[model samples]
Target: MRIVSRRAEAVVFGGRGDVTVSPVDLPEIGHTDVLMETRVSVVSTGTEGWILTDRFHWGGSMPYPLVPGYQKAGVVLEVGAGVDGLAPGDRVFMTTSKVCEPVHAFSGGHISLSQEIQSEVLKLPAEVSDLEAANLVVAQVGYNAASRPRIHGGEVAAVFGDGMIGQMAAQALRARGARVVLCGRRQPRLELARRYSADVVVNVAQHEARWALSGIAPGGVQVIVDTTPSPDMSLYLDVLQPRDGQVVLSGFYPGGLDVDADALQKREVALLTNSGWTCERLDATLDLVARGLLRTTPLITHRFSYHEAPEAWSMIRDRDEDVLGVAFDWTTP
Candidate 1:
């Protein structure tokens, strides 16, 4: 067997309050693997922030010195013997990679070079730009939320949180013919949601969600999607349509999330949750993005070179700027 040693660079979260770019070595590819050189990768400000501060709660115990990212667009450098429908030079979107030791993979997608399983990689469409595909997983999360409930055209849908996932969920709901109402505290994100996806924008900072929702959707909304890390389910319950309402939980709650089961039972609301991406959903999301239905590029408020990851993390943490979608350009050293 021939051996190959690959050196790469990646963003490392060394325990709480630590972020840096460290050198890494890629593992040898297996028969079903594809090695890629990342071109662009989007940051999950919410998830990465929680992990950076050791607040992430899904998995048991926070692992230190880990790579934190789960989505990127890149060029395939090599394809394994058993891999089909993919070739070197193909532009594809990938999630996670088999990063070798010491620095563990927190779903590793920010690395300069990645060796991914064939199933975890997707070939991009002709019209889909790398930037659009770079945030596929997060976009799929939105898609998952919007697709969970059964709704008809012209139904009212309320999306809580104006972050990337929330915005994406709003877009997906709009695509499904729902009149979307976006609720958030960030003015810039709320404005973007109004311009692109939502029919109405509510600043939760200025007005009460229950009051705003009740006024805008007098009969109550049929669909409620919560994408905030710390969600107030009672607020959503107050405006949920009786008997046929559906509530989708799509955020990361560090201390664990709880819902009012009695309230849900009284209204007969269907409580649903979305976690990860699926191949079919990714395919549909990529198509929607390529067809100009999912508005991704417009949401990109900041771009930094891979070397500027520290600055990017700082900006994400500080919130001094009205940052929305942050991407790291890895095309150069």
Candidate 2:
């Protein structure tokens, strides 16, 4: 039997509003390989959204014609030799890095862990939906972010930015028994933060956020998680308490931060940075989703088809109509 497969991918053509979708030949499945017919994929509202709008600070030298999605959920249409426990028609989570290559060859550049693709492709639990699994990748990042250092019960944690990741961080922190205070400029998003377990939501756009946070916690917050990249890191630094506090930078800020070194020294705050989730943490996140303890379904505010990818990016870029967690619907075959 002949298998004809065409993969439609999104690439940056030139500048903003210039995205091109083209069909690429799908390689045959190798041993230990699984061919997934993608049912749903998530548009990373933070990273990909910024790239689509050309707001990315990586200069124009960054790789163009890049496949702009990292999180995808699909059904296995074909399974390779020696692959056990997974069959055609089984749902699985697809996690890949920015690049991948044949295992034996290993002819690619320096094999960094981030670039190494770990296909911990497991069958999706019966309770999980395609959209939910697609979002699980990001939720894993949030989970790992919260799991780091492990906040104790009754601890005060401040999550910066009420975006998807920030909201997820708030939920994770709350699950760990931390009283989360979500900070963001958008009112609607801040409200969603509260629904996701933020004890208090501060609208930076409306009022002085630092003063508001001080009012919420007179002793200062125990932990401050920055999920939105701001040029001024002082906003987060000011909210921290003296001695034994922590600041987790989960956001991508390409610029330099203007902060008071003296203040950080005086406060004895521990600064930490987290990129994405490790393989182990990803599994833990999946377990949380399977048990229904973590719910990302409510975070999805908009959905679009593969053809509507450009418009989807625009929705995030223009901040159109209070779009929160956007996902691409690939369920239609």
Candidate 3:
């Protein structure tokens, strides 16, 4: 392998609706860092979308020019001298970056960068392709959503939204043996959800969500996972099982996320939210993938070559109803 200078391409969310491609030079790695050459990276439409407008829940204090992405896979070009279990030529998935200052990278993975071993970085088996490996980050997020609800086998779950996380969460719920019904407003996205997971699909725009939900679980859904960027409970309050329903919010909610006090008091529902993924979740998702149990091919709705990355921002910003996840192909020069 040629020892090329460390130059990386990144998507930077500039302050107040301005975003750009900022390139930075990466010096040699320290004792605990490994330099990664990005192969592909996935864009999180909801959270990064809000960050573009500086409306994310944690966007108030974050500095502008933030590098937004946590889902990526790449080849290890160089490993820290002290690092063990990893080396150059090994393919890995990680969530770290060495971006320039004046950028609050919530967590990095959009392009090539240096990462510490202590981070949630792991080596992938040779059989797992780059696309599937990059997609694991979102899968891990979905796992967190599915696991947090304590979904048990034979239980009924209703996942709101047909975005990437919702799709992955639906699959995770299925892998855990829960019967899942994915509810969304778009027919195209609901159709895509069918291919990934979800034993049942409901188009809320075409029919009454509550009625459709009633047909699936007349007794009321035991758990509901919402992946809408600006999540609200009122839209699906009627479907929540009275007194013991568990609602998990797996996306960023920009607007006020308050429920009807009287209605919630009467139902006594539980509310939970998650935005981070653990290493355990990553390993579990990969294990399922290796076993041919988990599906991610459907979530790859939008893919762009590395040079088309500029257009990629627009694709994600004004995303069509059908787009699930936006990924940048970094194989190009």
Best by TM-score: 1
By lDDT, the candidates rank as 1, 3, 2
lDDT per residue for candidate 3 within 127-205, as digits (tens), equals 7777888888778788889888766588899998888889888998998889999988878888888877799999888
Positional deviation of residue 80's Cα in model 1 after best superposition, in angstroms = 1.0
* lDDT, candidate 1, 177-221, per-residue tens: 999999999999888888997999999999988989999889899
- Alpha-carbon runs more than 4 Å astray in model 1: none
TM-score of decoy 2: 0.86
lDDT of 2 by residue, 1-333 (tens): 644443334323344556554443344445666666677777677776666555666555334444565667777777767688887788777765222211211111111111112265656888888888888767877776787755769989988878888887788888889988888888777767777648889887887978998998888888888887773467666676767788887887867566677877887778787875566777888888877767888878888776676677666778753788887666543
- Candidate with more favorable, higher TM-score: 2 or 3: 3
**What are the C-alpha RMSDs, in order, of all predicted structures?**
1.3, 5.1, 2.7
Worst 10 residues of 2 by lDDT: 105-114
lDDT of 3 at 68: 76
Model 3 earns a TM-score of 0.91
TM-scores for all predictions: 0.97, 0.86, 0.91
The CA root-mean-square deviation of candidate 3, after full C-alpha superposition on the true structure, stands at: 2.7
Comparison by lDDT, 2 against 3, better one? 3
